[model samples]
Target: MVNPVPILQTIATETWIPAAWEDFLTFADDPTLVGGRFYYDQGEMRIEMSPLGSAHGRDNTIVSTLINLYAAMRSFPMQGFTNTTFRKSGLREFQPDLAFYIGEPGQTITFPARSNAAVNLNEFDPPSLVIEIAASSLEDDRTRKQALYQRAGIREYWVVDVNASQVIAVEPSKATQLRRSQVLPGLEIDWVDSALKRAQTEDDGAVSRWFLGLLTQ
Candidate 1:
C-alpha cells in the first residue's frame, strides 16, 4: 500500500492544496498520473488508492471490460468510479471495489456534486451498485463493507468470488432477517473460462455472442 502521508505532501507542496476533492477530481484528469494512485486525508476519513493494476489484473480487467462493454452498447450512462474516498456520517471514507451509476442515456440527474467532490455520503445517495472482489480479505468484503454499504443506503452490493467464479448479490432485509437480493440481477463472471474454451476450438465468436446476449438483456 502507498503511504498516505507522502502522497498528501506532494498534493500540498507541488500541486494544488486540495480543500475538498474538486482539486483532486480535476487533478485526476492529468495525464502524468492518469493510472496512478492518489491519497488524501479527511481527518477521521479513511484513505484510498486507485491505480490501473492495484487489484489483481483480472479483477480490474473484468470490471473495466464489462463497464466499457455496457457503455459501448449505450445501455445507460455508467460511471466507473473506483477507489475514491467518500465522507459519510459516522464513518469518514469508505471505498468500494467498484461503483457505478446506471441511468438512462442523456438523462443527467441533478445531484449535489460535493463542493469538495468527496461525495456527500450523508445524503445517502450511494452508488446504484457497489461491487467487492474478494482477495485475501473475504471477511472484510462480506461483513464490514456489506454493513457500510447498507447504512450508506446503497441499492445493491455484489461480492465477486474470483476463484470460485460465483457472484453473491446482497440487499437489505428486516432487522431479524439476513440481507439478500431478490430483485438484483446476475452476470456470467467466467470470462476467462469462456475465452479458454473458445481458444481450444472455433467457438470463440459463439461464446462471445452468448455472453453479449446475456449482457445486453
Candidate 2:
C-alpha cells in the first residue's frame, strides 16, 4: 500500500523525506508538478524545486554543447539526454541534468524523442556517463547522488560546479577520481573546467570555437 506523499502544501524541496517507491512514482508521473527534479534512494525521496537560475542554465548548456562537440569530432557513437528521469523502479530513481551513452554501436541507446517517459534502468543498462549540475549545494551531488549512481553501476559521473567553474569527474564503477574522461578518452577534466571559465567572458560561440580547436588539434 503506497500512502500519499504531500505536494507543495506540506512537503518541502531539497530535503529528503521517507517515501515508498510507488508513492514517489505517483508524484513523479504528475505533470502538474512542473520543474521538479527528483531523486529516490534508500527509502527516501528529495525534490529539487529550486528554479534554474542563469548560472545553472548557462553551465548546463555549455557542458552539453562541449560534450556533444567532443563526441561529434571523435566520431564516437553517443546519445545525450538532458534533464531526463531514469528509474530503477522499486530501488532508485534519478533525474540527471545530463547523461550520455557512449559506446560501440551495439552498446549505445536511443530513447525516443519527445517522449514523456522515464528511462527504465532495469530495462536499459546504466549510462556511460552521468552529469549533475551543482545547484544550491555541491555536497549532495558529491555524496548522496554519487552513491546513487554508483549503486546503479553508472560508469562515469561529473558534478559541474558552475559557481566555481569546476567539474568534479569520477569513475563511479571503479570508485576513483577521473582526471581524464574514460568514456571520452583524451578528454581531460581540466580542459572542460577551462572551457567553463572561458565561457564567463566569451560567448558560447567563441567558447565552441576554442573548445573545438582543442579536439581537432
Top-scoring candidate (TM-score):
2
Tell me the TM-score of each prediction against the true structure: 0.55, 0.91
Task: Give all candidate RMSDs, comma-separated.
Answer: 8.5, 3.6
Q: Give the per-residue lDDT digits (tens) of candidate 1, residues 96-214.
A: 66776665666674453645465666763667767766655466567656666776666767776655545556663321221333222233335533533343443435645655786
- Segments in model 1 whose C-alpha atoms lie over 4 Å from true places: 1-55, 71-74, 89-92, 104-107, 111-117, 173-210, 213-217
Candidate 1 clash pair list: 21-116
> Candidate 1: lDDT of 174?
27
Worst 10 residues of 1 by lDDT: 175-184
Q: Give the TM-score of candidate 2.
A: 0.91
Question: How accurate locally is residue 72 in candidate 1, as Cα lDDT from 0 to 100?
Answer: 57
lDDT of 1 at 117: 60
Off by over 4 Å in 2: 1-6, 104-114
Error of 1 at 193 (Å): 9.2
